[model samples]
Target: MTSTGMTGTDTTSTGTTGEPGDRTGAHTDTDVAVVGAGPTGLLLAGDLASAGLRVTLVERRPHATGNLTRAFGVHARTLELLDARGLADELVGTGTTLTRLRLFSSLVLDLSRLRSRFPYLLVTPQYEVERLLERRARAAGVEFRRGTALRALRQDAEGVTAELAPPGDGGAVTRLRARYLVGADGVRSTVRDQLGLPFPGRSVVRSLVLADVRLADPPEDVLAANGTGDAFAFVAPFGDGWYRVMGWDRRHQVPDDVPADLDEIRGIARRALGSDFGMRDARWISRFHSDERQVPAYRVGRVLLAGDAAHVHSPAGGQGMNTGLQDAANLSWKLAAVLRGDTDDPQALLDSYHAERHPVGTAVVRGSGTIIRLAMARTPLRRAARTAVARLVTTVRPVSAAVTGMLSGIAVSYPAGRGAHRLAGRRVPDLLLAEGRLYELLRAGSFVLVAPRDTHPAAPEIAAAPGGVVRAVWANPSRRGALLVRPDGYIAWARG
Candidate 1:
């Protein structure tokens, strides 16, 4: 087992016997191996490959499925991230722009108050997002091993060794060696299970019914109800008289226990919509209960976890996918740095990922749990308290904005490390740049400095940088380059 020149052919099994030909062929080797082909994994693979690192992506699914509309909303911060990679424009072109998010109960709180150029949400299914990212990853020369599952893993000082099995019917196992491994698998991740990490959280008592229905008479607005008498629903218009209806089953029924018949779905719809709405077509339906769980740590040894593997909470504010994408963005650059041998201190730099992301995950779980609990309060006294709080929040602009900002992921900030400026953790606003937008600057490479207008001071000495592309840009404050921006679309350091 030499450290160098390990490709797709070398094979040595510890316990399980692999397919005869598996060891005969060259084994695929890369700087990083990513488990799961979901949004986070695909985005991470694309980023790592684009950064000139060999990346191998493994997915247990035999092929891509575009049927499930799991996550339907993309927040402003996530939009900014995609925009940075030149994918936002394409996404906005395909998806509908949600200008307003109206909370319905005894009162309404407009989500448009969140500060940003993209003050609204984007309505795009999770499948579309994965498709775009997968395309980008393939274009970047990433090797995607579809229908592959990790059978076993062993890490040493040099790199990680993963034994992968093909999907369906026990097939030959292939050995994959990489400098690092990323677990982006869903809640029940084999990677997390192998790592012996504890996922601590409680499941909600009541289960909810979700459906994508084409209504004969659709609601005029996007409505999110906290407590609507007997049911709670979050309705978002997806164009063409289609609405994504999500509501809690007052009877607290599970998917298996209750029939998924159209009549049942329509009953739930009518309860929330206040009308016997005729559902012409029902695309998909499922029952799910809210669960709040987060991994104690995002990293262990050479393996790391992202997305649902790292944190799982109620989808109250649609923060799941957005939070996972942010996880990919934040970890990609640092991993690239380590792989490129820019620094010898791997543990210190890697620890920051957990430190920065854990708090945000905690906040999301706590906040979303609070919102869901208040909305589902059964007693009259609790309902009154919830309504009073909502009204009071609406009356105070700052308080309301702050609450909305947290849900939108605009309030996430990182701690300033070595060589980091005050703006390191803060998100950089979209500004006009010579290249095009401030996000365009990030597409080139990581650690960018937007030089102040009319000021050409000596460039900061950036170490282990990627060629000359990592230099500062002289931005025109009047047009663009108003301030320096980070890869995560946050202000690293800015000047007026």
Candidate 2:
């Protein structure tokens, strides 16, 4: 996996199997080229490769680790997706679980009320998640072209072609062609730029400080956040010996790149929190502003965008990575189906990704924006009113559950048509039948038909469906009714 051997120079070799990433047949390889190796890209690549599609994940960086991430919360719906892939247990084992989220002094989001297998939110940094997903992608035989940047992207009705830059200067460029190209690249995406898509939004907040330091005493809560009228602060642990602290001061409206020292950050934390909790050992420190931005379209012919390339907003509920992960899950199956010609109508299958995900991405941006704006209340009266309304909403059981559901993504559903069945578009719960949990059945990477015991061999005709379309598995007839569950755990077309 050297740059010279890969995209740097026109050198190719053929290898048998279980190799890191080998060049075969010399010319540009792969059915699909993924522009980024983030969560969305890795998940989509893993699913695509596992489905026997040639996937090449192109990342600008040589290695996946070392980047400090602000993402620490994995919601219930995301946990269910991970469970389907058999990766949830490992993440759950390594992370801390918190039943509630506190955005302000008098406001708390109760997550335990959410009706799901994983009611509590898992608090672990994004690096842990990336590590696991990268492992899964590699095991799926997805080729990784690291230390190479996508310099240009162009596409036609047939396929996409990309020009890539080498790791160092004065190096020769390489050209790769694929049937489809995905821009999972970050905010400043070259793929998006080449396609001339407008990222329409403005910066929400600025001069926010981030520090992962060792605290003399960590808070008792798994996660904590508080906002005074003038400042805001939040803290979450890495489950190791370090803590991630984020805060911003409204009084100091300075440039984002202005160098921030520990003393200034600690003072802001002290204003937000009663004490800094002996904040010391400033291991990592940086500053960034939250923005609310989304592209007008997710798909343009053979090119599609996902993750931060598609949308971005404030990290109020830690929904950025989770939304991107779910987006990957939603788009992967559809893309694989179309690429493999598994579906009857490939265009419809491809269009459904945008129809379903664009609205969801829009909702996330709005929700996250609301949270950040409410937290940034400039007046004491407004802050008090926001706190009161939030607390009151949590006091009511149903409202609290709905709030948690929104934040956790458990309440996400698509349009199932005007005369659709009651269960259509609803998320199928992970039922525990006599054999095993329902998500265990989805581990094979396909849709499934769960029916009563009498229907054990009912779907024999569909059991060996091409591209793992659908299979029938019997559940407890008395408790759970027959249903058709989509690969992402949503009830596509079901009957009670």
Candidate 3:
């Protein structure tokens, strides 16, 4: 039976609510439907809905929890992106500022070298970031459907058809049809599975122990690290005297079999931080080995993957969340353009997302792998060598800046194709505008081109692109200018 109901309830065979009727007959229609309400999905949904697109976000989980501490730091670039969306100040206010990231081994490297308004990392739990994003998404009029799972997806000439099931009962199936679908699901994404995408990568021989615990005596320092030998430990202070501790298991020689017990945690802390440390209550604990992997492509037909679904790498550099957020920002603008009939070449623009992001992901995987190996080298010779290199780099100002740039994600640049200027593929540094700050100006919407230098003769033509906003100003000379900044805060084009 062909039913034209908007309530998401339609009868099918077997008397189930959402069961597909005949493969040919079932399809629900909307502008965009996003699978998973994680940070990426929520942020994308919010951006799309805020831009006046109809969006529906589905999550498999029945309720949100505060237990997991999956990701801990939001880098400077991420803060700038959120600030562009008017979200950074609120989030930064809640999380503690990581003034310095000190690397300790045979030698020490202080990360205060990176210059930014947000010079240090912001330490906030993954759940808290998600909570804030979810609130913002709701405020932006995103339709959030909790306790829903996407069972199957099929795309055709017009749009995509997704079969969704309610959580526990598995009672009814709803057919949601959308012009496009995004899979913001995590590493083990069902959408990826359905699309038959290849997630190729390698897993390191060693794994690390990660836990969020209430220490009897938390470290006074914002972050402490001991990386002298095969055994290494890093402790960072979260709010409320709780600490997130990560360390290598010296005795076991691997991350597997590391118990989630307080006793084991205390023992690790004793080795990494000194014997006097006391660990009282364990909040959450897990074992994770580094995996460097990326999907060969970001899109298959109308379904697209973002966040962990597209790339999963070592947590050593804290790039996971920041990368995911940027992915959403990049995709959101393109998706909005296509939905609004402003772009004729949707696939070309869609391909640009992967083209721009894949290389960045590759670099992150390689850089983070190097850092992890250096931190976990067992042999005395290799450890000594790693220590010497770290110390040398720290002493050199340019080298330190480079390392800080890598960690802060400010150094990433995307391709601007042929005939693009030097600023192509670079992040536009926050600049001073005649009216206000550059970041403040971007808070309104996506795609801002700043003509700070007044050098580009084509500034008028470039700014006049359909559906784009360009701001022209005189060069400060103290700062960089004439940048094509994406909604995600990365420089798409720049001038020397």
Candidate 4:
């Protein structure tokens, strides 16, 4: 969700924002300055602050965000990320989970087969996730300045300086400097514009209406979805009585500004799903468009981008918000390491943020685009063929497993260097430790050296070599080798 277009100013020449800090000639006022307090920035800021870095989060919106609902599905991988932060179970309790997702009326994708503890998609409002993250951030000492917008940002070898416009019109401009900056400010990011990054892609669908309503007769399935040649519709419970309904009509391809009504949504649902399930009494309704755009690079000098600021996708597989949260998971630890002087080459480590995440962003953009295009296939013959092919492919166990893995993001991985361990760059499954589980240990937000109980006596020292890396002994000593798992639950290094 973009802000009502930023002030479109880039006054970086003189740091005269009428603040005393601006006249101090200091290299940096804080460790990190994060724009946008959404899921991405909140997670990043919380992680950085937890790692002892001073972080400031800026949000253009007021503290009271009314009915802020968007992005309903949280995939398995994203849930695992939250688990590492000790928030997964609490968040899971606030939403409903569906083990299977139906597409095009037939061809169900089974999420129950996923290996993750969270093997299903969680159906929750975007605000629920944000609320939890914002609470964690506040507890971790993240300075949040609501009703503040980033007017401009200038980066140099030393640090980045940001020009901020405060709450009201004619409010005095403020200057903030930090060692690094991040743009998690959604699609229309002012930080991105100041960096001159091009978000190159086009809109995938127009006039898609979203609403939270009550179903007079709820569908037996946890989720209901189908796409007729002329329209597409999906409905899922919010765990509350309210169900989120998304529908699009081919005949009514109006602009996003056009007000959406229950009548229009009911017509589209009936056409696409054969029935509206007696939908009634809408709680919220809005019209919008979906796009598949991504920035060329996620990093530029001292500034980096995450979340919708770096990439955005069609709401086809519900990957938009999950991907952004994962981006924060990938970048936060690396940034903490660099800022804490845990790395020899900070630039190389920072560059790896783009290297690892940009490819994932690209894949999500393409995958979501393909799913949306196929859902909107015009001809009857094409739709039948797609359904047939989908059924056939899904019947094959490996193909179905692969499909679910990618869609749920459990199969996502970074590149390993030459001669690296096979486990390196791969996701580390939740292993049983002597005292607890792998994810529980990750709540410390540090590297974890998981060693077999029979490993060398020096294993503890080796784990300690990485500063705060925690040493975990396997409950099953029969397992071989020692694995170094990153804070994000990915294997970093392993030895037989």
Local distance difference test, each candidate? 0.72, 0.78, 0.72, 0.82
Query: For residues 1-496, could you state the per-residue lDDT of candidate 3 as single tens digits?
Result: 1100001111121111221111233345668899988888988999998888889999999886465757888998888888787888888876787767765544344555555667778888878788888888889888878889988888765677889998666569989888788999889888888888888998863657788877666676668776545467888776767778887665655546655565665676677667425766777787777678898878776778999998988777788999899889878877777667655445556666676777778888788777777876778898788878777776887887787787788777666655656555567667666756778877766566676455553553244333566665644656654566665666555555
lDDT of 1 by residue, 383-414 (tens): 88887878887788888788778877777776
> What TM-score should be assigned to candidate 2?
0.90
Worst lDDT 10-window in candidate 3? 1-10
Better of 1 and 4 by lDDT: 4
Model 3 misplaced regions, further than 4 Å: 1-28, 104-109, 167-169, 205-207, 228-230, 253-259, 452-466, 470-472, 475-481, 493-496
Candidate 1 wrongly placed segments (more than 4 Å) = 1-28, 224-226, 255-259, 417-422, 453-484, 493-496
Residue 333 in model 3: shift from native, Å? 0.9
Worst 10 residues of 4 by lDDT: 1-10
Between candidates 1 and 2, the one scoring higher on lDDT is: 2
For model 3, name the residue pairs that clash: 17-172, 17-173, 18-172, 18-173, 18-174, 28-177, 413-425, 414-425, 423-494
Best by TM-score: 4
RMSD to the native, candidate 3?
8.2
Error of 1 at 389 (Å): 1.9
Candidate 3 similarity to native, TM-score: 0.87
Among the numbered candidates, top lDDT falls to 4
Question: Candidate 2, residues 1-496: lDDT per residue as tens digits?
Answer: 0100001111121111122122233344688899999888998899889888999999998877564776777999999999989899999887788887887767788887777889888988788888899999999999999989988877655577899987557567888888778899988888889888899999998889988888998887767788776898988876777787898999887886888888988898899887788889988788888889999878777788999999999989889999999899888877776766665545555666777788899999999888888888878788778877787776887887777888899998765654456766678778775568889878887877677665643332234232554555555456545666777887665554
